[model samples]
Target: MNNAAQYDTVIVGGGPAGLTAALALTRYRHRTLVAESPAAPRNAASRGVHGMIGLEGATPAEVRARAWAELDAYGLTERRDTTADDIAPAPEGGFRTMLGDGTQVWSRTVLLATGVIDIHPDVEGFAACWGRTVIHCPFCIGWENADRTWGLVADDADYAAMAATGFRAWSADVIAIAPPGMDRAEETQRALRAAGSDLVQGEITRLHHHDGDLYAVEMADGTLIDRQTLLWAPPQRQVPLVTRLTDTLGLALDDDGFVTVGADQQTSIPGLYAAGDLTTAWEQGAMNAAGAGARAADAVHFAHPA
Candidate 1:
């Protein structure tokens, strides 16, 4: 058997969460290894990332570059642009991880910073506007386009009504499009209208955009309604690595299919921690993920103090 390299921790991602954890660990002077997959990041299409202080209006690349640059000063981390193909408890202790390039590494602790994957709806051209105008979070993308026409792709009546009404803070003109079979549709429409908002029933046939710049949404009958932005919280799933290991590692997942962790970001499995979107959808953002990463690093450091 090939001798495995050892480290304090092996982070399975290199985005905001993973990089932030590395930053925190390096602050403790711990040897850390970060394994980032070769695939493009999830936020590749974002025009700008808002609501994150100091990083406001930064593009995904810029945010990543700034994060990566910060790590250089520490000089305490080893970065590999490869996927963690497999992860499991080592016979001796800690964990053993196989990289995509077939190298094995052993770590005293492992941080699963691997984020979630957003499952887009089946509307034509919806992807064209995703991460730009077709966003999931208002706080992150609503400021620049505030007061413009906005659309909410509602999956249910309550969700539609609540989100559409709350969206009034960002735009005077807000509309909710709820597909067929929505419960309490009438009540939701009445509530929305009373709140000075509008609700449209049935499916959206297409997203009207030019080069990914959204301007409207097309109904099934081919009716187009002007909308500068669309707030649609699509369903998400853990990345393939986490999913494949959920049962193998016996990791606990929440009802919503996110990895459940303790107050310190440690997963159900000992010496295994998780952070970012893989943990919770609530407050899902790079900034929030970074905060979670910081907490996990603290926990890991204290747990293995010299």
Candidate 2:
């Protein structure tokens, strides 16, 4: 085996979280390596990234490209086309990782920014309308598509409450579609009714699209509801890197299958940290990832103060 390549820190996945952490570490004069399997396509489906300063309406690829450019200018070493396969505890109180191409890297600290994947609802032609008319986030797409007919597709009662709050700004004519056995609370029903939203009871059978635009949703009972836009919360699953590394390093995962991290973003395993969506179930975008990455870098700096 080749000798382990050493750096002050190694960051896995070059999304907003990893890039932000790498930039912060570089400013502190720490040698950092960023392993990116490949950049995502510009047309990849995402509603929009919210809460990012000066980039409220930006798409995921747009935000990532801008961040990458900024980090590149700062001389951060980026390893495109490389993937971290496994991470193990190092004897000298750090961590060692194996790359997909058989390269080994040793670092004083490791930060995982591997993002989560959205579990899309099984609806016909829904993929084509994603990121355009069928969106996942209200904070991101509500302002853009305001005053249009919006449909909130959900199967959980709690999600109905959350969706009620989020979709209030877009349009007063919101429809909450819930499956059987999931009853909305009295307060939730009152609030939604007060907001002028009608509760539609049915399991969505399929999405109807016309010329790549969302047209309507068909219910299982043959009910067709015309809608201009569809919004819903996505069930999420962590990227495979989280599971691979956790198993390799024997790190602990929380009940929700997220990497268990303290306030400092440090995992149960020493010298290893995780931030962003990999550690949280809440809906977070570029802003949250960037903030978490910065905090993780600062925490690592404290642990190994120069």
Q: Give all candidates' CA lDDT scores.
A: 0.87, 0.77
Off by over 4 Å in 1: none
Over 24-131, each residue of candidate 1 has an lDDT whose tens digit, in order, gives 999998899999988998888788777678988888889878887888878888889999988988988989999999899999999999999998889898988887
Q: lDDT winner among the candidates?
A: 1
TM-score of each: 0.96, 0.88
**Lowest lDDT 10-residue stretch of candidate 1:** 158-167
- Candidate 2 local lDDT, 1-306, one digit each (tens): 247788889998877778788888888878888888764632266656767779876877787778778777878565556878888777776788888887888888999988777777788877788877887766666677788888887776667765456666678677777776676555566767776666677788788988557788898999999988888666777677787766665778888887888989898887788888888877466678788999998998889653
Clashing pairs in 2: none
